[model samples]
Target: MDNTKIAVIGAGKIGGAIAIALKNNNLKVKATCRTEKRLKELKSLGLD
Candidate 1:
C-alpha cells in the first residue's frame, strides 16, 4: 500500500505549488479546485 497521502485543495498558485512539490518528491497527491479550468491545469501539471 502507498503510505504517502496528500490532499491539496484549491489548486491556485500556492496550492498548485504544494501539490507539485509533494508529487515530485514521490508522494501521492490529489489537488482540487472549484473550476474546471483549474482542474485541467492541475491535470496538466501531472496530477491524477
Candidate 2:
C-alpha cells in the first residue's frame, strides 16, 4: 500500500506530537513552523 504524506503547519507541542505519532504509524511527515528555532526543534525530533 502507498503511505500517506502529511504536512503539519504548526510545530507546537500538540502538532509535533501528532506528526511524530503519524510518522510512527508509517506516514511521511513534513512539518512547517513560523520560526527557524521551531523548525530546528522539529527537525531534531525527526520531522522533515
Candidate 3:
C-alpha cells in the first residue's frame, strides 16, 4: 500500500492531536506552525 502524507496546519492542541493520530496509523504527518520559534520547537520534537 502507498503511504499517505498528511499536512496539519497549526501546532495547537487540535492540530497536534490529528497529526499524532495519523502518525499512529502509519501515515506521514507534516505540521506547519506560525513563527519560526514554533516551527523550531516542533522540529526539536521530531515532528518535521
Alpha-carbon lDDT, every model: 0.88, 0.86, 0.78
- Worst 10-residue lDDT window for candidate 2 reads 1-10
TM-scores, one per candidate: 0.84, 0.80, 0.67
Q: What local lDDT does model 2 show for residue 1?
A: 33
Candidates 1 and 3 compared: the better one by lDDT is 1
**Predicted candidate 3 versus true structure: per-residue lDDT over 1-48, tens digit per residue:** 357788998977688777777777778789988788877776766677
1 against 2, candidate with superior TM-score: 1
Q: Model 1: per-residue lDDT, tens digit, 1-39?
A: 368788998878899999999999988899888888889
How far is 10's C-alpha from truth in model 1 (Å)? 1.2
Question: Looking at candidate 2, what is the lDDT of residue 11?
Answer: 64
Error of 2 at 30 (Å): 0.5
Q: Quick one: ranking by TM-score, best first?
A: 1, 2, 3
| Best model number under lDDT | 1
Number of backbone-clashing residue pairs for each candidate, in the order shown:
0, 0, 0
Between prediction 1 and prediction 2, the one with superior lDDT is 1
Query: What TM-score would candidate 1 get against the native?
Result: 0.84
Whichever of 1 and 3 has more TM-score, that candidate is 1
**Stretches of candidate 2 above 4 Å error?**
none
* Pairs in steric clash, model 2: none
Each prediction's Cα RMSD?
Answer: 1.8, 1.3, 1.9
lDDT of 1 at 11: 78
